[model samples]
Target: MRRRTYLAGGASVLAGIAVSGLVSRPPSNERLLEAAREPSGTGEGSSNTETILSGTDHETSLYELDAPNDGPTAMVFGGVHGDERNGIEAAREISDWHPDAGTLVVVPETNRVAVENDDRRGVDGNLNRQFPADRGPQSELAAGIWDAVESYQPDVVLDLHRSLGIYGLHQEFVGQAIFHSPDAHGERLADRLNEDAVPWYLPFHRFTPGESTLSGPLLFQHAARELGASAYIFETTEFLLDHSTMVEMSRLAAAHVLELHGLLELGGDA
Candidate 1:
């Protein structure tokens, strides 16, 4: 059954809805400059060559690092929202990085327009919202990328994003970090995953999926599986950060993910 909901003002929200407009933070011009240069490709070893998703503005692109492996693949998609810096950063690290002997697909920014124009969605549309089947302007941009994802058939899909500065009611922001929404599955520790030093919720309750949001990891989690893929979301601390720090956190998560897949050089990379 399909349900439609609006973006909630507070943290606590229910699931199953079509959220319109941008979620929370939109990208600023300064943020867009982080990767002003044209995206290039790199696939050393058994990996395949990298490529960029070119927009009207060539510089505003999604650089994908495709490593060759026929086994169950892992897709690391970052920067679907221009304002969300952590995923993009992680994508960059993985591109240059060679993890294990398997296929790894890294898309630094699914929404290139958001990154380039420093906007949530691109000039034409919001890539994440547009995914799964976006024909473009007349329809949705979501199709292009999500289609790739479906065809890739990644066993796991890790999407990087931020927790919309929600606190108390929905989440809590501690200094640089912000806790994210729990999965529909009731995995408590899963909420605080990949963190260097953090504890699971002191109290647990029935998970309340955030604002039946438009499109994102939430949508992917439910939608992707139907296409032969599992999905996960990695939330970064709310707010903008220095490019370097963003890159580092992404690397940490990527390392953890690789380790989880047992592709980090056979054993013990985490």
Candidate 2:
């Protein structure tokens, strides 16, 4: 389903106050949306693309969207597992969007080899599991991705994926869920999606927010632990929903996170 667009007003007075260093408070969703819709006075919201792991088998494009205003930075990833095409598509779409405030860094196909082969992992094993908590990334590909993360120093990190079944229904699968770090706003994102994007007839498909397992060597977990960034892993189920719905769900999750971090506006339409 196509998302509904919201017509926003002028930039909020709250944003002006915050910019002037007169008050410190979280901007309301409406205010953020308004601010994001406003034109950046500076011609700085330009986008650039670069190659990650250049001249290597795992090479992929990395897109960076810099807004005219200075704000928090967000890094988004997809294609960690090749079979998860929804996330890959959503990330690719997001790569072309323009952020209104902070920078947006996107790696649409993190594991290019796996994506090409339609497999879960590349020859070096699961790319998602290569980032151990105590040490540097174990594989060359993982290390290159990690290097980008370190260089950007993003305030938020979002990893998108797909699962074969619902998170609670399937013992090993974690879909229709947002696994988040302690500092992340997973619950809020879940609530927003459930209220707007989810269909009433499919109550079972509603998004859930859960605390991420720190025991695993997941990229989101590693970023949260090491950089203290708000990190999340958004998963959509493939059991009942069609491919398009899954892509929409992943897109909504990423857009909402960007909105929550004041990087974008009207996430429902983003």
Candidate 3:
């Protein structure tokens, strides 16, 4: 089934018809600045690399940090929409945290052009929509971002975003809710997070499958099916939670995912 939903003000829709049978190839001239096969630390090691997307001047910083012991890898993406500063800030803060067991990869600003200009759609259109594709003439920025996601090969993925409307107030918008793919993986995480007092949640909903709408491309949806990993696109209502509170919630959400996979240990442990 396919559904097309709009964002705040009905300006953009998150509906992207799921694309099938598309072959994905890295953009030409895509190069990683790092030389190591794997990051260099045994425990709590971290490394930052710069990715230069061949044709554009846009540059993205990639961060990788491993825990003290072995565990699953979780990937976090922020700033898919340049105007959502909360998710971007949340992502940037998480990159500094040291996990206890697994690997954490973070791209704080996925759409640098949009983020830099505080625009929702970057120069190359919506970055989130142009993914899992076989071609270019597409945004070089989107192509570059896709290359990074595919190369990282995460066990789970999270794309962070912000919504202007409250879910309860605006039935059409995904505000104050977890807009996830159809999967138990995301449901489980959402259930746990919603248990908090004055919880920043409405209900769990699925994105329109197959193709791009106002909402752009569903990144986690493709990642979940193609990569065989649990994935979600988390949205926070801008008015529901204050900036600091939103950041805290984002941190908690990431921690919950890591803890669920045994990659992180919080508080005093059970």
Candidate 4:
């Protein structure tokens, strides 16, 4: 079927816009704990079940929706930046979401500190850059986040992020998409997402080489180095305050992913 035909209905809604990320002040130790354990887990543990996925007193939530069978495993990340609500919303859609094959390990809010403060930067004002699994975090708090992601070991990672809106465009960048150079795995992942079509700003999304930044595909691509994990960074534009737009954008992204996995039938209700 034609690509657009493939994306007809809700999936095509992904073709709506573009978005982007980081910032912050030193977060209190207790606050970090709260941010870590904020979101609920996959099953009926509580509104805070996703919190347990982070371990003892961990603040950020990791909502994983899957069974421990065989097949491939996927990691769909949302909310690298707290202000980037679209990614968080998208990951939530994926959490209650289930698929036939493989596994889905989701960390809706990778950076809890930012999520709580509604700030983009981490405690140290640095982006939560230690991804693609290096050592653990230098600080006790961030180290906890690093540990969770490293352990999950998702096969394919989709890091959800958003752009800065108009000012971002003036940078000659309406929207940017991350793909690994010479890495077919990353390229293919990007193809899977673009196939669903999104409300990208430019005529087409900008495909950049993953050699810079401590976040997004750069980190995921780096992590792929050791784990052989295929990672791609997805950037959508952001205005925030527009809660409805955020909700719909996340819904479309989730629907697009469901289409990729052939589980649109499951619906978000899963």
**What are the lDDT figures for the candidates, one per model?**
0.46, 0.80, 0.61, 0.50
Best by lDDT: 2
Kindly report which residue stretches of model 3 are placed more than 4 angstroms away from their true locations once superposed. 1-43, 52-55, 132-137, 181-184, 197-216, 267-270
Q: For candidate 1, lDDT tens digit of each residue in 14-38?
A: 2211112112222321122222121
lDDT of 3 by residue, 66-119 (tens): 766777888888888989887899788777767666788888988888899999
Error of 1 at 17 (Å): 39
Candidate 2, superposed: residue stretches over 4 Å from native:
1-44, 266-270
Clash-forming residue pairs, model 2: none
Rank candidates by TM-score, best first: 2, 3, 4, 1
Per-model TM values vs. the true structure: 0.58, 0.83, 0.71, 0.61
Q: Which number leads on TM-score? A: 2
Candidate 4 per-residue lDDT, tens place, 20-73, comes to: 211121233223223223332332222214563245333666665544233456
Clashes of each: 6, 0, 12, 32
> Which of candidates 2 and 3 reaches a greater TM-score?
2
Predict model 4's lDDT versus the native. Answer: 0.50
Candidate 2 overall lDDT versus native: 0.80
lDDT of 2 by residue, 1-270 (tens): 111111011113222322232112224433443444454545548889999899999889999989987889999999999989999999998887778788999999999999999999997999999999878999999999999999999899999999876677556778889999987898899998786566655576688999876657999998898888999999887665667778867876777798888887553443
